[model samples]
Target: MPQQSAEALTSQQKTTSRRPAGTLYRGREGMWSWVLHRITGVAIFFFLLVHILDTALVRVSPEAYNAVIESYKTPIMGLGEAALVAAIVFHAFNGLRIILIDFWNAKYQKVMFYVVIGLWVVTMLGFLPRHLYNVFNN
Candidate 1:
């Protein structure tokens, strides 16, 4: 308070002039990727739990298991299965990308993220039509 030096004043001004940090993620690609990864992981975990429980029903009662399996054959469930596939594909590819990032310590994460999206789109394109046909035509 007695005497502020020029450097100190300039630095204080710089700090005050800058915008404040906003959201936790700042709405960046990395944030979205991180969010999607966690969401998909939780989703996959729940799906696996349900699948295991339903499959275990076979040991208890075959008719109950068959009924549950048949209930999944509807068009609505077909669409849900497609969404599950999309989540799995994204989660898997992003996991590989994350592994590569950790292994090589590269700076191409943004590009790799786009690559993951591209691959997911291509894979879904290749898989969806046939899967949907089978789902609906049956």
Candidate 2:
């Protein structure tokens, strides 16, 4: 067996160390997009579940349903609703990015991720002001 020279070993280690572990997306935009997608997905799911349960309260007791609905009118709940909308917007746009990756073989995944984020920001910007005004004023 031949022993590698110190310079050869050092150069090899430097190159290999610079390479990230795991997949191409291990710590990049793709990884964050994937993580945010799953998180927002679960958040949306739980929000929907809570919404359904609260709506179902109407069948059990109209007064209880009204009370619950009224409680959601607070500023805190308004902020929470904003977060929900943000999550929904991100999830929806990211879903489209995933579809493009799968069907269109999108090579510019990082670009697509940025596009999704930009779209989400634009959408939220359009929505938040009026919604916040209505929530805080009424």
Candidate No. with top TM-score: 2
- C-alpha TM-score for every candidate: 0.82, 0.84
lDDT of 2 by residue, 74-131 (tens): 9999999999999999999999999999988767899999999999999999999999
- Model 2 steric clash pairs: none
Model 1 residue 78 distance off true place after TM-score fit, in angstroms: 0.8
lDDT of each: 0.91, 0.92
Worst 10 residues of 2 by lDDT: 18-27
Error of 1 at 104 (Å): 1.1
State each model's C-alpha RMSD to the native: 3.7, 3.4
Error of 2 at 37 (Å): 0.3
| Sequence-dependent TM-score of model 2 | 0.84
